[model samples]
Target: MMKNNVSAFVKAVSLAVCAALILSASAVFRAQAEKTLDQMQSELDSINAALSQKQDDYDSLNAQIGEQKSRLGALNSQISNMDAQLDSLNAKIRILNGQLLELNKQIEKLESEINVLNDRIQQALDQIAEKERQIEATKQLLLERLRATYIAGNSTELEVLLSSNDLSSFLTRSELLQRVAENDDRLIRQLEKEQKELSELTRALAADKAELVAKKEKVEQERTSVIVKQSELQTSADAVHKKQNEIEAKRNEVNKILATLDTNSEEYRRQIAFYESQREKADSAIEAYIRAHATTTVPSTNEDGGTAPQTGDGMAWPVPYNNCYISSYFGYRDLYNTGNYRLHKGIDICVSGGSNGKKIVAADGGTVMIAGYHSSYGNYVTIDHGNGLVTLYAHASVLTVSAGDHVEKGQKIAEIGSTGDSTGPHLHFGVYDNASGQFVNPLNYVSMP
Candidate 1:
């Protein structure tokens, strides 16, 4: 009996020691789990903060875009007004040109008339000179004849009457002499009248010529004034045309700016879609992991005899669909056959053979952290799954979630696609530890689909 009691006591001691060890392990595991939960909560808070900041940035960008659009609209209105003003100015210039042309024609006609009048005046002067010369010659011939008659003893009218041959003959001779004297006086009066008329005509013609010259000069002066005015108007018109061209150039610049803004807006929308899809996929994965690893109660205590909490502790599949296969695994390697080395931070899955609109599910429950495109990832999405863990989905066809939105596990977030630097239809999945701010292998936390 003593031997049996001793043996039983030894067995009891061993059982106690084993129980103690188990309790100790249980305590350690509980502590670790608590630590993990705290870390997860903290990460969730950080994700919320980041999402808020991103939302603010997005709002500010949207407001700026609106303001820019308004400015562009105003510029368009100004351009329209400028166009109308330019058209009016152009019409005025055309009318001015027509008037100038007509004025030139009138001036030409006036000049032609002035030249004709000058020729007529010159001809009149030549005729008057010829008449004066003929009159002078006739007067000289008459004077010579009168002198010869006086020297040859030809008496005056009374002397001729006294020298008559007889009473009857002398009376007849006296009558003849009286008749000749009367004819001479009449000839002298006629020559004097002709000379006076010729002189008056010459003076009239000279006055007419002077008047015509003055008129021509006046018309020429008017033409010069018109030409100067037209030139001034032409200069003003040219200035207006230049201003119109400047306005047109400004309008074109405005149009280009607007086009750039439009392109940026489109890119932003695409980025938003990509992020939404990623968030959805991450939520779905987390739900799947939770359902698969669910427990009825906390597990037994460890070596320390402490209880452990029930929790999900399994890898998650990034995508909901099972039709795809991984083409590349995450690791450090050279890409594109380039000498430069880089880390392959994500797994590339080929989904080309999958059904159309195959869903991409989330890897965990968390808030959407990033819902846009990165330069390298293209159409990408990022979700913070808490505990410093963030899952990324890239190259999605469509996204259904948004930044800052709370997502549950196993939610459908996107459709698989080949967007942005993808060789084929596939999902590039990655996980990043927020605490380390470095990429980790997605395979460590997510099951392959």
Candidate 2:
């Protein structure tokens, strides 16, 4: 009887010892889980801080772009004004040129008329000299006639008649002498009148010539002034043209900077989204693991009530339709239209033709860790396979799965849509390993056509 009692006591002690061990292990697991949750929170805080800094940087760049645009606009307006001024200057120069040409024509006409007047003056001068010579000859002939008459007779005609041989001869000689004196006076008076007319004409022509010369001098001075003004305007126009070119070059540079800023802002937003989704998935995963391991045995079925994938590794194409092509590759990429580089963390698969609301399947059997929007991802979904592998499907129109819902490989989990920063209707598929805390290329795991 005593031996049977000792056996029962031994059994009770063994049972107590087993119960204590189970309790100790459970406490240790729970503590580790709590610590893991704390670490996740810390990581999320860090990511949030980084995201905030990125947002600030993005905002600052936008502000700078705005200022640059304003400056560019002002520069353009100034250049336009300068162009107008230059055009005005050019117009004035053309008018000045026309005026100068007319002035030159006037000067030439004046010079020609002055030359004609000079010729007229010379002809008048020559005629005046001839008239003077004729007057002197006529005067000399009259003087000689007077001397001959005096020498012929010292007394009057009566005395001369007394000395004459006959009355008839004396009468004839006296009549001849009177006629010669009358003819001499007439010729001398005519020569003096002709000489006076020629001298007056010469004076008139000389006055005209002097007036024309003075007018030509005035015109020449005006032309000189106009030329100087044109030169000044031309200098101003050239300076304005040079300034406009410089402003245009600066504007081009600013335009490029604005383009780059836009691209960088977009990239920062994408990175923030990626980090948010990661944090969300981590939270869900920690919760799920705690719940699963809390029990003695792991669940046989998936959280979505589906069997494990037949392909044990759970590697498969995310989309069931084979009519798609890889739109973007994973790595540092040259983004379209931006001419800038970006580190793309996922592969974008798109349909050949145009379509919307297409099915997006799970890449592998896993629990749906997250199904919500996180900025640029827009209606994002994260799936956690049991082996620390996670798949992300972004830009979904609709989510068919919820958190903790298990999915099989190739099962529909979401619908593709142009949400967030998607340029078109496509799915951004990504894979991450929690152990490494980094994304891996999906091609390394899944084979897609």
Candidate 3:
């Protein structure tokens, strides 16, 4: 009987030892899980910080773009003003050219008038010379007559007639003497009158020619001044044109800068979004891990109850309906019409009727790797199929799985809804090739029902 009692005591001690080991293992597992969660949380915090910094950078870039745009606007306005000034200068130049033309015409007319006056003066000079010659001739004739009278000793016409050889000679001599006296008087008077008239005409012509020459000089001066003014205006216009070209070139450079800035800002925004998504995924993963490990046995069924349709290849469509439309395809997408493209890492699914509250199913049987909320993905789930293939379902109203939970194909894992960064109720489904370390086209693995 003592042996039996000892054996029972031994068995009891062994039982106690086994129970202690089991409890210790459980405690160790819980501690390890907690430590992992802490590490993940730390990582999430780091990601959050990075996301914030990126967002700040994006904001700064946008501010810079705004400033550049303002500068561009000012430059454009300046260019407009410059253009107006150029136009005014051109108009002035044209008017000056017209004025110059008129001045040239006036100069030409004055030159013609001066030429005419010169001809008149020359004619007057010739006439005066001829009158002087006639006056000299008349004076010579008068001298000769005086000398003849002195030689005759003041003899009368009868004495002159007695000197004749006969009566006829005497009569002829008398008549000749009378005619010479009359001719001398008339010739002398005419010569004086002609000399006076010629002098007057010469004076008039000289005066008129001098006046015309002065007028011509004045017109020429005005023409020279107009030409100089036109040249100055042309110089100003040329300077303005050069300045405009320079400004236009500068504006073009600014435009290029703005384009580059816009591109950088967009890239930064995308990076921030990616970081946010990662952080949220990590957060949800931590929560799911905690929830899943809370119990001794992990639940195999959907945690958030729902029904889903199973349709497609080994990887099935994530949406409840097979007829769901693909709102966006996986690849580069132009979401903002900025002439810039962003990578769409997943396909967006929209169900018939209202997509909100529609069930989301796993594409294949796999272990849940992550189940959490994200700023970009909203409520999301990531399932790890055997091998390097993984599937993701995002933008859900509700998540029905936790990390570490086993999910079967077509199992309801979430409900579709508009969540963070979503435009409407839809499912963002993605396939990731772990081996390649890149998200792939989900359509390559799954087919439309």
Candidate 3 lDDT tens digits, 150-197: 996898767876788999988888888789889888988887898888
lDDT for 448 in candidate 2 is: 78
lDDT of 1 at 327: 86
| Ranking according to TM-score, highest score first | 3, 2, 1
Ranking according to lDDT, highest score first: 3, 2, 1
Task: Write down the TM-score for model 2.
Answer: 0.56
Answer with 2 or 3, whichever has the higher lDDT.
3
Q: Between the candidate structures 2 and 3, which one is better when assessed by TM-score?
A: 3
The reply for model 3, stretches above 4 Å from the true place, is 1-20, 73-77, 80-159, 163-165, 168-172, 178-313, 321-345, 348-359, 364-369, 374-377, 384-389, 400-412, 415-426, 432-440
Range of the 10 consecutive residues with the lowest summed lDDT in candidate 1: 289-298
User: What is the TM-score of candidate 1?
Assistant: 0.45
Where in model 1 is the C-alpha error above 4 Å? 1-79, 156-222, 282-449
Give the number of the best model, judged by TM-score: 3
TM-score of each: 0.45, 0.56, 0.61
